[model samples]
Target chain A: MATTAKSRMLTGSKAMVEAIDQEMERDPRVFVMGEDVGKYGGIFGSTTGLFEKYGPTRILDTPISETAFIGAAIGAAMEGMRPIVELMFVDFFGVCMDQIYNQMAKIHYMSGGHVKVPLVLMTAVGGGYNDAAQHSQTLYATFAHLPGMKVVAPTFPDDLKGMMIAAIREDNPVILMFHKGLQGLGWMDQLDASIGEVPQEPYTVPLGRSRIVREGNDVTIVGIQMMTVHAMKAAEQLKEAGIDAEVIDLRSLVPLDRETILRSVAKTHRLLVVDEDYQSYGMSAEIAATVAEAGLYDLEAPIRRLAIPDVPIPYSDPLENFVLPNAEKIAEAAKALVNM
Target chain B: MATAEIVKEIPVEKARWMYETMVKIRYYEECMVQAYAEGKTPIFNIGAGTVPGEMHLAAGQEPAAVGMMAHLTENDTVTAPHRPHHHAIAKGVNLKRMTAEIFGRQSGLGKGKGGHMHLFDPKVKFACSGIIASGLPPAAGAALAAKMQGKNWVAVAFVGEGGANAGAFHETLNLAALWKLPLIVVVEDNHYGISVPKEASTAVPFNDIRGVAYGMPGFRVKDNDPLEMYRVSAKAVARARQGEGPSLIEIETYRYLGHFQGDPEVYRPKDEEAQLRKKDPIPRMRNWLLEQGLASEEEIAGMEARAHQEVDEAYAYARESAYPQPEEALADLFEPA
Candidate 1:
């Protein structure tokens, strides 16, 4: 919990900006463009001090045009510019999906490898602030379901910094979705696990790799982004109940870390996939299918998934909390899986 | 700035092609209405038809599609909204394959992966989305691609007047103007966004005026006249091809059918459809072509028969084609590595 000389404690947003800054300084082609990315320094603080450092040319402030700018990012990328465009909210993918899915995601393949779109589409995701249905969604499955793009959600500052650098460096389009609750913002509820010691130097966390945050012999609890933070908390709660729960952070969804998941499920007889995305046809179902496909015999108990029921995230505090996956709900599901 | 005299400037061959395209689009929609009603006769169960799901036929909006598409080449890109059959036909999408896709057959455009609303024909550089106003940004991207590659090819996005209220519309307009991309946004003002009239949903009477705020020229084509559409879109297309930037054109179009097949007419006025039918663009265009001495009555009748035959063959092809294998639904989500 304490910061040492080798590493300093950074919030998820600061770590993300640090990686972007380092990348911009390193590559002249690398730049940031989005709504409020300049002067305002990103409403979520993802681009905080970079605007002062990079100025208007590099850190361009766009006119809230997710489709045009995002599409322009694809055009620029095709023309040999590595643009790091931000979609203010993952929920806003609705307005610009044709650009995201049809253009950005498929242009490379559609062009038969003749073109490469190496743009990083970073966006704020997750629900907990009572922002309601329109604003609050972690639609990981929506992007992951489409084949062309890579989807990553990093919870801690270390992985946030490292994976962001990796996403920027990757040749394909990478969707870097960060959880709002995990960003360590002053206005929203913060997660302690989101604040961690991150090295100042640039590093790359390989995409498609899953990390086992906690090792246990009894049950496997799989999560991504904010759910990983919840899963870790649930692990602690289960530990007190004498249930050893293994927590796996699935940083990337498209090139899913199925091997780590299968390996973990093979070790622990029970599996519980927790997600903040919709329950049906989402991350939970995909993870469940992965285990069922190859690691079915390893499960001693039926695989359980805890996710938001197929409903829009509501506005009121009680309603939003009721639908979202928290430590309590995750602990309950893990406990039930262990008992079963 | 296209006046009535500009309508005369349209080449006779182009005018004839536009009329034939409108006729073909109307016949296609009419055939689809019958095809969609096949199994749902007495009970009217929406899920019972061969075309199973919701069907939104663009019967009365042919002029807008042919007007803007008349300027486009095979290399130019088009991104259309959900009610896209008219645009698809006018843009030269293969009718049989598109119909087969609509019928959920294996040989369809997306190989049955994408149904009616999600048709993607890369050969002609045409794609459409089911979501409203979502196509504008991608169309801009296509235009941006052309500009960056130093090509004269422009991209056109066809959206409903209802879609103009979406943030994507404003965003795309501003972005396209700022970047000086060769893009055209055509708003087919069909008066209703699924029963909510434009007055209730839009702050402005006309969406074209919004283009002025975005620093682009905006034009409105009155009364769904195909010739007028051709005239106004000609200027817009010329400006875009010259790298002058994007333009917005709003066509006062009409939707003759319900928003979707099987949608009860509870929200519509009793006499609206009948009144709209009185000024059907297809018949009006036919009369205009005859009066202009551009085509003989026999030529117009021949065009009508040919259009009907094309629709007939497409429907038959769709009916005879095999549905995609159930397991094959999992394919085409991503291209192969």
Candidate 2:
């Protein structure tokens, strides 16, 4: 876009790693820690070379004692340090929920809001990695349900860089989730480790802004993380049939851009939300219920949602295909909502 | 920090002071129990328990408080477990205000919000906690802060025998050992954690062995004599103040009163409680002091009477203090998030 000649591709996680590495070189307090974060370059290699650059104290290699290390991070943050703690997988947040929900979120409020713990808890969430039931679950619903925390999941590489840098700078505690299945979906990563196409320098995209990736008016389709990729593909399919549909990427959940969603819905008049998590009472319901409560008269038709049914996300090709909402399901749902 | 011995035995004046303090604690607790039966206090105790008559191990645990605090300079921090009243007195947390705190008066440490075990006087380095084993890492954090700021200060954490089983205790010890933090962990093993025996709670025979596992030098002092706890704690204080990291002093003592005011004597065996009482550090150390001509019986008696008088005055002061205004309950509720 900036008249670049050598634009390339990269994975979202790899982009995050490069951004963190470059930031670590620039700043002193920005360091990473977790199981195998150092030496092992992180479990999924999300933190490669972080340990080598910073020694054990700065780039600590903690034991599997999540509660202790997380508590230690809280203390460290209070005592002036910006630690980027990796949860390995986000589902394990349940293990140290007390430190996350009780301490990290409430410390500032309890200290009469005198304390500011600038910390980032980065983790991989979502299913389809065959991470089984425990590791594959998406608990953003639990985090977003709470008031004090902010949640961000980026679908593209440039977005990851922007969100992460913002998360690091944010005075409040932020949870930046990278779904395991959407690692390299965008051309932000190349087969080689270089971030050739990503914006050369670091920058921040303000939280709670929805990027309207495609312009249309017939139906408004909302997608999150990996689901956004599918929603765009489905919008392309809808265009061939002359059914113009708007594709909105809901980038964040906590500081959710509801005003943006309402603006799109006012023009489109129909809403179709596609989520990879379970369909029952998930993000889809949250959005649908809020829209209904806020602008019941703005809707020309009932909102439609595409999500995995109220069941464990299946791993088999056919079963997973049947349960999960994809481009085909998004198009079908959008067609039904527009037709209504 | 150097682990050198205190270099001299307990002098006569200090022995009398220690004996009188212990006696005062014992008598004051017994008096509070009597007052409770006479309708002096309400049921809403500060530490999620009863009022008055609720003291535990105050008789045997004084020397650890006195000795551990003697070495601290102005900038050091100290965190205490539930039975923290002794530490409060030893560290100069205004006895009248502390007494007011325990009685749930408006002039209390947390302005009546936190009571008994929750004393929080930030002006002094003294803070209190009711959650068992919750104070370790923060204490280590203070020591880390002292190190970072280039100050010659240390932090001390005191807990009971059973608290060593908590993950907080173990992790703090490991981290202190790893960083060689200037801290002293005084394990006031008064034979029991509330009503559960230490043997029932821990697989390890003694807390000293557990301390050894964390790679710190441990002292299993048979502090059946209060003077011995003072002597051992002096060495620990020296080591910590000199920046030699933490040392664990397991003072094997006993509690004479019931766990709390209302707890019946059903859990403790009759003979077991009697055996522990016989080994109570107060009288044993008293007789030792008298035998060694360190304190005359009159001197010890006078100290005991003075401690009781002090307690009586504290009770009077706490009673006269006005109740906190209703709106004060919501005050200091949030710092600002």
Candidate 3:
């Protein structure tokens, strides 16, 4: 039986652990498999008690062979099991890409849409401290290149837990990328899926849809993961400038709900996309281009975007701050847009 | 057929299977040689092709295949190299599909996409790879998966002497040994990889020593002798089934044909092919069967004739079968039903 929870103070990372715990308890098929996830309590401490509580078999400790384990997970997924594999770091995905792109994503399309790989690839992304370029990267853009795959970036605990469950329930292969920078924040421990709210029973959050966390009428803000927090802060600053901004959390990128985005763009007639990844070929660029193609004529002004410069994320705090998009940067971009 | 009926006639049945397999491979290669000379298949210019100037055959390695694969179960997996005839025939790949694959027909495995070196028959657990040691890790993964699922299955990877000399083989073996994975490395030691002799490629005096490097039991068998190969491979296969870890069984074989079907034998001496032919395992097994009163000369000849006729018919069938259609090319590219 799942351990039911009400109000409790938990970090975002801890919230993810509790969510996975409750998920494993709710469904017998749901299991966690990854390297050192069993004995090490996760490199981020997200899964502290899980290994001892669930045993090593269900919470498998794999070899450093990412390709092998990923392929094994594909086979396991094909055989009717929901496997959530934790790639120690997002960069390690390069080693097991064949299983991710060729086998998992293409399984349904390749099998003539016969099989569904219900796999959740959870990996830690983004650079905050000195982990270097390899360990910390927003490589969700890499996944977005492929078809038949979903990319979910959750910023809050409740949304994180909900989106994680929704990703597991998805019939296609889904990549749930976690930014290392947004490790601990806040979320509802228990979520109700049926009514898009806290239910009397277990439930999940909807995918492919945007959440309007903060609403306005003057302009629309497309917030990507950590950018949402920055966007909210930017909105508070923009309020003083008499510019109201509607902030949208783009939960799932691939099956992006264009209706919601176009509706916001229609209401505001101006869009400002904020992302932490590199500006070139980044999510900001993708969203800006998508809006132009979909609602080009409806726009009163050209779309503006705020993102990290197209360079290796710097090591020093001074350099890194300039490299990544922050609240100040978002405010500056939004202020510039409103002034125009 | 049940194990009892199968084992009762194991010797005779295995020999017959060996003879028929040899005939299938021989005739298939002969057909490709003719087709290659006729310019029916295209030249890849660099890598991959069964067409003229791009193919490889196992003319003398038939015994190595029949001997080893004779010990396999349908549930077990087989990892093969580019020169994959022996494994292809041994794994029960349809003669028609096999020839079509060599012919670069749309009817081939991978639907003419992978062609010769890259055959993937999920129904029979045959995973072919052009990369020398590429198949080892996957086979090791398959074995681990089998063990995890608690299934009585084994995985065999057919590596060449050159690949057995590579690091992938060693790494895969170490991991398989550590996990006690139900896998076996069947090193088909044909002495030469393409043009380079085994000595120039490896420091280990013999390829069989490469087996012990993985901490698993190793064996060297007369690859030209089908029965001996069968005995060695059967023991290993059974041990793997019984939860024993991997084994390295090196079959000291020879390639009667060139490295590839249309390849010139300029690197080796002219009489080498003839010398290897003298140890033809099919006829050797036939002679052993006759002297032991297991089968008559007429029976063996008749079986060979039947085998030849079957191959001829399968080729004709493949030739007459419709080309897989342009639209169908994209189908089954991934895992389409």
Candidate 4:
């Protein structure tokens, strides 16, 4: 929310495009290839202006062949090319799960350090505009369950730009899941924190890092991607009631910043994990398990996780809203934790 | 147009090299089969903890492997199917390392992680997939990189006739041709996919002709002959290298053994294997070598002995090599953060 003259105000999608543009300009081997990435400028606007800037060779548009294109990205990466490929939606992973999980994810590790797959698989995630079950999944946990790649979800423009650059420069495969609500698309409802001042100069936000957006002493609320925005809002409301709520935005999931989470929980001694992914065996469960295993003594109350119940995301707006965790739900969970 | 009788003049040196490669592949597979059987005593179990997993031996498919591989260079890449040993050897993968990998040793191509069906050798730009026709997409990817980088290198994908019926195969071929990528898709028609006959599984009479739907030239090299296989493969490879886009070349070959080490092969008609053995590419190639005066009887025997010796040495090395430690299984899941 900083309005200083020195910083450039950019939307999350624009920042992502700039990060990719900078990386592609720096390394000739780095290129973007995926469906609708060229003429359409990316359906989510994440690749806006990249086609006109880089031309056809670098900003290649592909057919709707996920198995072929994603598999091709793996082959190209094996041949010393740094390719940034976008899967249109994380929900569509079912069509080409073998290519992503078996080949792209397992190749580097199976090669016994002899080979490296420096590829970035970017996909759109989350649901709030009634995009339905197919288009509205935050399935980064599904990817993180497999042991090969890094999964990142950024809640703000600055974090998106920095993470995009870092993911492109990384030698291992990284999955960058952008929540639809945080893209600052004008047609869609935009969160105030989605658009912010970003550094014009290209930089990398280190992977496996967490940001404490709000610090407090009473409780620690862990969130990622769209859920982080709701948690921060809940914190603002809790402040009026004199209940101190700490909010943490988990930027990366694979090499999870457990130390930061543990440190915050040690101080607050009350935890509420919020995730857009489903409840059972998900990011929420993993975070809760981490706290219970390592920071058991610091817990002043039982850990609470507000996540989607085990059900497919529905297309109906009210039904979808009922399933998704929101600021109200998060604040209620926090109040319970504080009261306990 | 009538099927013109295509006559291709072969150089003596090239013919000699092809013969040598075919012999080497035959000997290597024979050794692996024997080694695999040695661990399976009177029981004859597929999973008796010797070679451990299913081994799909490519005994009678030498012509397709050597012929298509002869046009490849170190810079060029290839993706192979479940039956990949012949392709691996023909593609210039280190034999010692490949054998050790088959034995699950620590010094193998994937350090014992990938085993035989999933071998990946960066030196030779070789990779394989256990899934049917899954190799086509990755091969197209390598070709994509070559086209983007403006390199003359080509990538080859090897799939069986049954695999050619897969959706991925058709999709990849279409993409390669549409993008004008430097790729050659070789369909080795081996008559059977495990227990299912190619006739029952494949819709098209000729898998190569399926390329017409994708606007690419298609050719079928018939009769189990390596020289003919080479002529067709060289043309397809040249088409890819010249930026004429991808081509489909199907080589009619056969696998000498069952689908896997322990497959009963009840689906096949009686004595079908024995009948197909009559058209084995190895002896046919040997006869051509003698008729063309490319090698004397004594020199040919010497070459065969050398191949056997090479395979014997590889077998010994694999036997002596130590297996990867159990704790090492936890490693290589990802690059250290």
Candidate 3 chain A lowest-lDDT run of ten: A188-197
Between which residue pairs do clashes occur in model 4?
A: none
Ranking by lDDT: 4, 1, 3, 2
lDDT digits (tens) for residues B186-228 of candidate 3: 8888988998888898888677676666678888886467777
Instruction: Report the lDDT of model 3 for residue B26.
Output: 76
* Best-fitting candidate, scored by TM-score: 4
DockQ of 4: 0.63
Per lDDT, the best of the predicted structures is 4
Off by over 4 Å in 4: A1-6, B1-7
Model 1 residue B259 CA deviation (Å) reads: 2.3
Evaluated on the second chain alone, the candidates' TM-scores are 0.97, 0.87, 0.90, 0.96
Kindly report which residue stretches of model 2 are placed more than 4 angstroms away from their true locations once superposed.
Answer: A1-11, A18-27, A114-116, A146-148, A182-202, A206-216, A243-248, A255-257, A278-282, A303-323, B1-160, B166-195, B221-249, B253-265, B269-337
Measured on C-alpha atoms, candidate 3 has an lDDT of 0.73
Query: Model 2, B125: alpha-carbon shift in Å?
Result: 6.5
Better of 3 and 4 by TM-score: 4
What's each prediction's TM-score? 0.73, 0.74, 0.81, 0.97
Model 1 residue runs over 4 Å out of place are A1-32, A38-60, A65-84, A89-120, A124-150, A155-174, A178-206, A212-247, A268-340, B1-8, B199-204, B264-275, B290-293, B296-306
TM-score of 2: 0.74
Task: In model 3, state the lDDT of residue B131.
Answer: 67
Q: Enumerate the candidates' DockQ scores in order.
A: 0.15, 0.18, 0.21, 0.63
Which has the better DockQ: candidate 3, or candidate 4? 4
TM-score leaderboard ranking: 4, 3, 2, 1
